[model samples]
Target chain A: MRDEAVLRHSNIWRPETIEDIQTKAELGRYRIRGFSALRSRVLPSFDDLTFIPCTLTRVPLEGYREKCSTKTVLGTRFAKKPLELDIPIMVTGMSYGALSYNAKVALARAATQAGTSTTTGDGGMLMAERENSRVLIYEVLPSRYGMNVHHLRMANAIELTVGQGAKPGTGGLLLESKVSDEIAAMRDLPAGVDQRSPCRHPDWLGPDDMILKIEELREATDWQVPIFVKMGASRVYDDVTLAAKAGADVVVVDGMEGGTGASPDLLMDHTGIPTLAAVCEARAALEDMGLYGEVQLIIAGGIRSGPDAAKALALGADAVYVGTAALIALNCNKPIYVEDYHKLGTEPYACHHCHTGRCPVGITTQDPELVKRLDIDEGAERVVNFFHAMTLEIQMLARACGKADVHDLEPEDLRALTLEASMITGLPLVGTNVVFAGGPGWKKSTHR
Target chain B: MVRQVECTGKTTREINQEIRRLIGDGEQEIVVLRPQARHNLGVAVLQPVKLVFEGSVGYYCAGMADGPSVEIRGSAGWGVAEGMMSGTVIIEQNAGNSAAASIRGGTVVVRGSASARAGIAMKGGTLIIQGNCGYMTGFMMQKGTIIVCGDAGEALGDSMYEGRIFVGGSIAEFGNDAVIQELTPEDREFLTSTLTQYGITSARPFQKVVAGRRLWRFDKKEFATWREAL
Candidate 1:
């Protein structure tokens, strides 16, 4: 018998998995990329739980005619004029430097048409965006790039961004190629310069220092607009509690799956928690502090469909923010221009080269030619359509669950599909009363 | 007639509220008395009124002035005349840190000394400091002209983009990404006119500090040279 030796493929620490080692060897610097977190870790998510519709005990509402309100009131805890949105979904912050001017205008117009709000991201407020948007939330980022008192007053609300879902502890990285003359003018940076926004605000030190800044903002705006504290999902319970104590009317928690203009892949995929776990922890923290209803919670990161929105609502989110999904809705990776994608060294959906300033979809690039490809009117229409579809889906789900209002969704309407989800959400598994962690039969003595 | 008001027993909020009400009533000339070094005096003044403060004021005095012309008769604390949009703010005495920070299309004149980071991040405005300026003056400044008639401290114009800083006296040191450029004929003429307008006629040979432009674009080889400057 001839003995044949077989060489098995190694899965543990695979050396030839895409040959990232070769790329690192060829280039001294690690590859910088963009887009959402692409890690394959199986974490607890909204998909882990399924909603239970109306049956014998519960009564179902009419889907076709009956009115199910999706109205959302935010920043009611402190601000004199809290925001009233016709829909619960709002556009997440995407800076002008990271996106084209036309993209920003499109988002503003679409949000206005959808009867929701849009956010002014890292850079200062663009004139077109401010004029088009009915309710604009101006972001006061750590960089303070375009912070002006007049612009601050122009906003309906102000968001103090400490971190993002993609890179929590790191600052933003804008490549020199993207920092055009126009963008540099807006950001107050040298044209064609690589910019690294500071990770922390230059004026504030810690939570204690945050109190004074919040007061300063309140005084600056005459206590008219709501103060939102946005944090990337890390130490969710503690961060949410601290934000509440710091006098935040709204707290936005972004998970690891959040997208960015440019970031190190290590930071995006490895850091922060999942959106499902973050919302649960945030709600738990608010509930524990007895300020759940007072301070609204908004969740983001990987929110795609209406089912995802409904599940997030049931898990304790007051509203939802869409960034990557919104971009996709605007034809970010629609495979329309194959030649342009080829020139970018990428394809439609697989493109993550936003930092290169060569986006084929015209959503993220600052190049005038590329920007012109995305028509403002068409983009706005797409956004309005996407928002309407999402709203309809959410309303449909709510009516099915016999909920008259979208805010009426609670965890009781949901059941965990897997034991891991049950443990994470503290919900009963399907067709079982036992949670195994802290359910009806949980006992310390028995577990010990 | 000057519409005079007293802030002796009122808080900053009340004083500002009264100011707002007076401005809303179309009062062009207003006088505020007994300021007593209080913070946020004349903040967010949007009207084209003339506001005169009688006594010393605290931090952020005359903040975010749009069309108002404010004259502070006494000294000010930190962040004086910050973010003034379209007005003239005259500080009679010394000002603290971040004086005239991020001013956009306005004029701020400080008669006395200014602390660190004066005119920091100023976009479009003219800041004239008659007295000496502290370290990091005009740090990361974008588009503005800052004239220091007296001596300047360390790191002047550090990481500045396009703004120009004219120092009439000796500079203690230069900041990163900053270089002493030759005083041009246009710069000298602009400086002379700006100073003459501000009633400063001293013939101190001025040195202009502008961006080196080395840090504008990132090159791996050039980062080593400009890293210390930033």
Candidate 2:
């Protein structure tokens, strides 16, 4: 008696699920794709949090006249010179090999203009990036690709990347097509060969060994630069605590929605927690050890706008890092490259073919022809504009919350729209007195 | 007169600054005295100068040397001559693990024995070790030549790609995806010229090692054929 049209398909074996299973059976392999955690899941995020703006009890700062400072400092605990920024936003680590040289240059130039730091990702420091970036964070990953002591000294900070959010338990992949001569040279791999970076550092097996490694690196750098430990958002509480105990000046947490150049589609969708949950865990871990503000926390992954950045800060993150958003601001998937997009078997706004090394907009490719499509000046200007816009939005939010400084905004300034968000962030539910048990109200829990 | 910098009580930063200052002033000949195992000597120096270290050095000695010539009279610690773009680093004594790692283009001559993972990930560089090399020499090497005058330890060349290794002495082991290939005329010439340049006279036959050509490419259709076979 049921209508056939109403009962389209069962949830267990949906059409796409069936197609994926059939494809796996035929190819005898899992799907490989770019971008991270794109599966349709209603994960609680900043969107589920609404700011409690100042009212009669507190006076709100005027948007134009009031002086609200966005200046932020990181690595104060153990670094001789901590990173000072005009804004709390930073450019996350994106390797030169994964991104075109032009794109790297643009990012460096833009970050410099914004008075914020840009990070040197997996494949070491590019000459152009070093020359253009006023402040640069050098990442030392498991692969040790293009790593050298000289470059280590050249950095403002050293980010020891234990894992990435996209593929926490897995390594990275630079397929053969993307392995151009320059990329190959930088990574010390053969031209036209797939490069697989290791999942864990060769020198360190656990936190005990990591402590020694951190000391070694610190001594090598003359204790001038800060040491940051970046971990994927799995076991954030334990990992952050260990990193802090190991003398890390800063801890960076990347969530599931972080982008990658190339990763198995299965891993992207299945691994790691969301950015919303990650910040809360990291903060709780730091606070438990009485090292929350002493060791700055920077969170990334799916940070799209000013609101997202503000939300992260409210959840106890000192700063926020952006990657995909910065790339998009530089015109990653604009309508002009529709023809190139079609050639890559994708289109604007839905493109995830960064692994192909044939990026339509020239952001992720090493191909010279496609690389030239992005003008460095225009791209840098656009990135600067994006940072400005995002910072403006953050200041507005902070002002409306009646905070003179961006860092003054606390968890009390926010309320979760959903119970899930309230539980994750430990913030109070909107229009409710209930302080959820796994959240900030539970004094016995480490989250308090 | 050669510009001299002493590292007796000075920190690495002071020594580095003095070296940079001397190099910036176009001092071609520099002498470092009382190194006392100080690390990062002559690091990232791009000038075409000659630097002579009086004593043993620590980790990353002469790293990222672009065009300078660095001579270490004594032993060195880990990662010596790492990522040298172009230049010459002569270690007259022994070297620790990961020597000449990821070197792009340069000539690194280790007169004494080398520990594990020597010449790891070397790209377009030449590493000549007069003595034995420990396990995993030339591990994951790419587009370079590594020559050992003495015996090679376990995993002679593991997972290498497009690089050539010449072991003048007996080999103990070979790692995954690494196999011994017949010494070709080109390889013989390269080995001979490299050995002669480093003043290494060896009567033992040299065996060539290269990637097994199994992991050169990955085919989705032939997944098991490649992954499992390797």
Highest lDDT against the true fold, candidate: 2
| For model 1 chain B, the run of ten residues with the poorest summed lDDT | B221-230
Of all native A–B interface contacts, model 1 reproduces a fraction of 0.23
TM-score to native of every candidate shown: 0.85, 0.84
- Residues A1-448 of candidate 2 have per-residue lDDT tens digits of 8998887897889997887787676666566667667797777789999999999988889977799999999999988999999999999999998999999999999999999999999888998999999999999887778877678888999999999888897777887778899888777777888787777554344887577567667755667889999999999888998999999999999999888988888888888999998998888888888887899999999999999999999888899999999999888777877988887667898888788888888898989998998899899999999999999999999999999998888888889899888888777788885667575321224553
lDDT of 1 by residue, A119-195 (tens): 99988899899999999999988777777778999999999998999999888888776899988888877788877
| Model 2 interface CAPRI class | incorrect
TM-score of chain B of 1: 0.94
Q: DockQ for every model, please.
A: 0.21, 0.21
Task: Give the alpha carbon lDDT tens digit for every residue of B74-184 in model 1.
Answer: 998777777678899999998888888777778999999898889887877899999999998988777889999999999999878778999989899999899989988
* Weakest 10 consecutive residues of candidate 1 chain A by summed lDDT: A439-448
